[model samples]
Target: MPPADDIVYLDHLASTPLDRAVLEAMLPWLSATGAGNPHSGHRAGWRAADAVEAARAEVAALVGARPGEVVFTSGATEANNLALLGAVPEGWPVVVSAVEHPSVLEMLPELARRGHRTAVLPVDRDGRVDSADLAARLEAGPAFVSVMAANNEVGTIQPLDELAALCRACGALFHTDAVQALSTLKLDMRGQGIDLLSLSGHKLYGPQGIGALVLRDGLALRPAILGGGQQEGRRAGTLPVALCVGLGAACRLARQRRDGDAARLRLLRERLFGALSARLPGLRRNSPADGLPGCLNVTLPGLDAADLLLDLPDLALSTGSACAGGRGGPSHVLLAMGRTAEEAHGSLRFGLGRGTTEAEIDRAAERVAAAATSS
Candidate 1:
């Protein structure tokens, strides 16, 4: 079914291939003259700085933020740490969803060490955060609540607007790890009551290791990385102009094509699932009907996820977050939803993206089904 055993990338949730348009936009910055240090004061630096600012503007527009509010980072992980540590005072209570990304979930130990009490909001069977439980937690008075806009593995979109309103009523700041929501959802930071947001470029068809933290106006952060006082002294590092350009271009294209792309991806996902489910008996879908259109999580009860990968080498997929790749453990996301270890380990996540094609989907489905039936 696959054309010449070509590798089909179904792991877009982990990372996407860089877009050609983004590459073209970044080429200028890769040139010799375009390689000036953004911190330098000379003409070269000014030109490099201009490119970075233009990129910043584009990323800001993507999330309905002002250019001045965006802070460049190595990636979403750093951005998340900055937002959480900056807004949440030591000894203040903080609440986060149980299925949050490791970037958010891993903060608990450090926060505990700092004397900040942490409470986890549990998710329903559908992987949606419990709004009523959140209300009960707010009674304890939290300094902030960190909930993701969408789950990276299950693609379940959270009721962020409602959550934000609840946080506001409780006089608590709200932060969202929106790395997976970009390009697939309309993000209006202020209108959505999001005090802080984290994003990644690679997840949106841009360069890896480059992301931004969009902060609300008048929000201040203690510098997580101290150096020569760059990025208004909030973060100090020599900015990468080419990567910024790529991220900007990616954001621009994603904003322009989001609606159409979402519709197309949804159709492709259905087609893939339809084809595979018809062939593979006992197939179970983990993602819900209201999940993100770009992602599908499913389990073939008797098939081992590792064995599935071994059987179909041409289709790139994963059991869970690529960040945990090779760790050989059950997905915490699935486990938190009450899946047994067997079911959790049997799951595979299909993350469709902009360049995904019907042909590719058909090939992937056929291969997956054949493997499932034969295995």
Candidate 2:
């Protein structure tokens, strides 16, 4: 493997490196002096609780939600599980997009087993759900809908405002798995009509092992985990103070720098695509023009992406979501977007991030172009 500096990483969708500021904010909580549990009744406990609440407020501010509305969980997977399993009444109808992450897609079987009426809404070639399809589904009365704000693989941004509006018209609750959207997009939970939003710390340059579910004020869900009754019994567990602090710091930094970061990333992403297309004219862009700023997905027809990735050890890239990569299958997201199995296997996802630069993009583009032509 190449040294970290030698490798041009284009897999931010898998995970982002921890930010320096986020680490600084978490250092105190990771130290012995920061050992007090928030549930305890003492000076140390009070201080810990204060730190947690402050972090909570920071997270809330980034997404235009109240501090109390954010309920911390182990990560976005747990948050998704909680949002879907806990929010929907038993035997109630629930809907999700065909391109959702495995965390959300895997819920269908369990939901069906538990007697919930479950359905999947399809996406277009650009990986966008048709609001009319959702409107048709919502005609069944109030149902819980889980659509990601942006796709993890293609980085396609969904029409949140329109989808939320459709759901509202029929009294449906709209939930978005926003783990991949927070850093690149300005999210307004209430304004966007998002009833429940799931987020992960690692996806936004924070520490792993922490995520949150932002619930619309006054919305209630059944308890997913039962214990000492924490977070007003919405989620029950001892909060990891350091992780929470890291997530909070990340959210604060994202709020402060999101616009600038998005603009820069957009330029870098386009540069990479342009360079590759110039060299490999046969390259087909799988990512939409209006997708996430840092993401670019393309298919080099007749070449297998998995094999291409194996040859380019110095470049960090992916054939699909890291979570699903180990499962040895063509990407479900691409398949859902109407790609043939061959096209899906030929696709590669480039996820640029805060550290990506023009030089790195150029270098990566050359390397990829060379590899494709040779293959």
Candidate 3:
């Protein structure tokens, strides 16, 4: 029943293929332009710096932030770490969602070691943080609150405006990891009242090894990495001019194609889900109905997700969080949403991207249904 021996990548949630336009934009900075450190004051260095600034502006424009507010980082993980650790005032608590990414979860142990109180707000079955419960937790006083813009595993979009309003009322800083949501969803930093936001280049069809953190004006965050005066001394290092340019070009392209892409992906996603459900009547969709257009998380009764994935090599997918894929653990996102360990283990995430086609989705759906039925 499954297709034979041909690979069709459907794991966009893990990472996306780089756009040709983005690659073309980056080609000039990689070698032809001259190797000059962005921190240096020489002519070539200034040229590189100018390109970095232009990229910064493009990234800022994507999320409605000023260029000065964007701080380059290695990736969204680093950006999240910087935003959380750097922005938290001394003696204040930190509150993060229970379904946060592993980077945020792992940081809690260290924060506890440093004598910072940390609380994890629980989510509903839909994988959304309960605003009322979050408010209750924050009643203790000022604390930095971080909730991701969207759930990576489940693709559930968070109510950022409500969360930001709550943080503002509690006089606390708010941060969002927008890595999974960026370009897929339209965002306005000012309108949402978000103090900090993190984005990764790879998630938006750009190069890896680069990301940006947008900070609210006048918000002073202590520098975690100290050295040369790059990134306005916020994040210290030579800027990756080529990767930055790629990110900028990717952002511009994403903006141009977002509406049409979303519509197309949504149709394909529905078709895929419908096909799978029709074939396996007991199949359950894990992601929320109103979630992001391109992502779908589903579970088939009596099937081991890892085994199913292994059997269907033609259809690339994930058992749960890509970060925790090989570890053989129940998904924390599902557990946070009140699913049992068995249900969590049976779930798989299918993330559609700009390159995904109707034929590919159909083939993938057939493979998934075959796997589920066979198991």
- True-structure lDDT of candidate 3: 0.87
Which lDDT tens digits does candidate 3 get at residues 228-332? 867777988778889988998988888888888888888888988998888888999898878988899998777788888888867879887777776778999
Task: Tell me the spans in candidate 2 whose CA falls farther than 4 Å from its real position.
Answer: none
Report the number of backbone clashes for model 2: 0
- TM-score: which candidate is best? 2
Q: Estimate each model's TM-score.
A: 0.97, 0.98, 0.97
lDDT of each: 0.88, 0.93, 0.87
| lDDT (C-alpha) at residue 272 in model 2 | 91
Which digits, one per residue and each the tens of the lDDT, describe model 2 over residues 1-375?
888888998899999999999999999999999999998899999899999999999989989999999999989999999998888866679999999999999999999999888999999999999999999998879898999999999999999999999988888899999999999899999888889999999999999999999998888878889998999999898999999999999999999889999999999989998999999998999999899998999999999999998879999999989889898889999999999999999999999999998988999999999888888
lDDT top scorer: 2
Q: Return the TM-score for candidate 1, rounded to 2 decimals.
A: 0.97
Best-to-worst ranking by TM-score = 2, 1, 3
lDDT pick, better of 1 and 2 = 2
Instruction: Pick the winner on TM-score between candidates 2 and 3.
Output: 2
Query: Which residue pairs clash within candidate 1?
Result: none
